[model samples]
Target: MKTTLKIAGALLAGWAGLAGAQPPAGDADIRHGRYLIQTSGCNDCHTAGYMQKNGQVPEAEWLTGDAMGWQGPWGTTYAANLRLLFQQVDEQAWLARARQPMRPPMPSPSLRAMSDADLKAIYRYVRSLGVKGSPAPAYVPPGGKVATPYFDFTPKNLPPMASQR
Candidate 1:
């Protein structure tokens, strides 16, 4: 009898935990999501060759992330594969991640400013695309050796600051 009670309790707990999971997004949500992604320029960096092709990349290839890196004072940061990232995390986790700051040239401020509905729509839209490709190369600190081709973002020849006066 005691064993039965414990099993029942565990089952109930599992069911309750699932209750908070996000539901499947409707067609409208997905469409809005696509719109947001395009308008917000997510494809520029996240999708390889997006800008080079003038946004002509196929939808199937969108947001898979790029091997290319952006190197600057902070470090080299690769755009993450949103599809794979979504697969690894639930909606709630995505929300938390979206709110956190990311190194340049990522626009973390734009993500943090988005409403929950907008964020959810973006998440749904990306997830709907399904996972493709492997994870991007890991971050390399400033001055670290980078194997992949990357854009040099280091500033050069800046004028002296007023504080130098």
Candidate 2:
């Protein structure tokens, strides 16, 4: 099931790259989506300058993806522009795609644990913001070249975990 969702997500993520039109949704649904997005810290990484600005970034710029890179044992991963990503995905696609694991810093486990309703709310909120900007830069595998600035996590000398007494 996991692999299936991953494959499906990959396909849908590429298949529908256009989502200017929004599905009809009630005010309550949109509100829930907005609430979920704000409270869940989605803007922390998804929106450029969000953290530096202390979450004061405008709603118009939310979920547009960021250029900042998180580099570590997994190489590098950029925050996906959810605004653009959700544009490509419909509600059903989001339900399945949301379950797939993403690279580091994505909190895939937290996303996977969310209820269907919560996921839908998140989707709705992002889509409501409308699509803007280009897709995030592609992933850079370990030992691969990276052009953008990144937060390096290459491990240095570190103490080992304490032995169980």
Give lDDT per model, in order.
0.93, 0.87
Query: For residues 1-165, could you state the per-residue lDDT of candidate 1 as single tens digits?
Result: 999999999987887789565556998889999999999999999999999999999999999999999999999999888889989998889999999989999999999999999999999999899989889899999889999999999999999999997
Could you give me the TM-score of model 1 versus the true structure? Answer: 0.86
Off by over 4 Å in 2: 1-23, 161-165
lDDT per residue (tens digit) for residues 12-109 in model 2: 77666757544467778889989888888888988899999999998888888888899999999999999888988889899999899888888889
In candidate 1, which residue pairs get closer than 3 Å at backbone N, Cα or C atoms, i.e. clash?
Answer: none
Error of 1 at 83 (Å): 0.9
Candidate 2: residue pairs that collide? none
- Maximum-TM-score candidate: 1
Cα shift from native, residue 101, model 2 (Å): 1.3
C-alpha RMSD of each candidate structure in angstroms: 7.1, 12.1
